[model samples]
Target: MRNPKKRGAAGNSNRAHGSSAPGVASENTDGGYNAGMAVFSYIIGGIIVWSLIGWGLDFLWGTRWIVLAGALLGAVGGFYLSHMHGLTSSRKNTGDRPAAGGPSQDGGTNAK
Candidate 1:
């Protein structure tokens, strides 16, 4: 047999303290913000690398358009590669596979 008065008291206390439950943890406590920043870093790294290359080429050839092209290419390619590899691989490693019958980010289908 359960004590109804004890249960009610517990619930009332939880309500008073703005708590959802006795021992349940919240969902926003993970490292998602860090992961997002890391991805951004990768994109920025690609742009810097390409920019340096373009700068060197310009220095050698005395042109002004190569650096812009390099920056553009770096941004696009970096984002694509990061989306395809970084995010998907992390999800796959964490056992959260993609949707069914769809191409996943890890170069494989999420078939059951």
Candidate 2:
């Protein structure tokens, strides 16, 4: 025979699984913030790499402005590329839901 207290505890645990549990909040902690960080890191990394390459080329060619120009262009391009890629990837990951007349896992229309 089970102890009365143990049986009560088990019953309470089962009740917790029901949908009406209080103090439950549904929210995603990981989302666009991570994507933004990834883009920033990519841009900074590209800028550093290009700057180094520019410095090396400048040293070899004895032209300082060439290195500066290359670094500037690389930084701008890297930022744009990273931003575009990050936006596209985020959308692809989250926006591929079915359209109208498609079956949804949640048994609801995909209209949004």
Candidate 3:
């Protein structure tokens, strides 16, 4: 009788497998996680930078409400940037199969 193979350490990596291991599962090089983190960083960075700018402006102008406006602007801009750069492409590549607006796929859009 032959024994079945078992999965260990969750998955494999380029360093472990030595070179690009296509079709293999791995966590060290997860594109989704990386994209998510990048989007999150954009949001947080926007907030921090804009808030600081607002603070400086407020200090120069002796106003108190500009900081709030700056924060809100930052959040909106961040969302826009993330959606424009990181998410749209990911949306198209949602699964292992080809995306929409393309031929040679098994099916079309799913009902929501």
Question: Which scores higher on TM-score, 1 or 3?
Answer: 3
Best by lDDT: 3
Clashes of each: 0, 0, 0
**For candidate 2, lDDT tens digit of each residue in 21-62?**
443322433446655766677767777888888899899989
Q: TM-score ranking from best to worst?
A: 3, 1, 2
Off by over 4 Å in 1: 1-30, 86-112
1-112: candidate 1 lDDT, tens digit per residue: 6677676654475542533654433454444665576568778988988988998999899999899888888887778877875542444333566557845677566655
Which of the numbered candidates is closest to the native, going by highest TM-score?
A: 3
The candidates, ranked best first by lDDT, are 3, 1, 2
Better of 1 and 3 by lDDT: 3
lDDT of each: 0.69, 0.66, 0.73
Minimum summed lDDT over a 10-residue window in model 3 is located at: 10-19
Candidate 1 overall lDDT versus native: 0.69
Per-candidate Cα RMSD to the true structure, in Å, reads 14.0, 13.1, 11.2
* Candidate 3, 19-103: lDDT as tens digits: 4555433555556765777778888999999999999999999999898889999988888999887553644444787655846
What are the models' TM-scores? 0.49, 0.47, 0.55
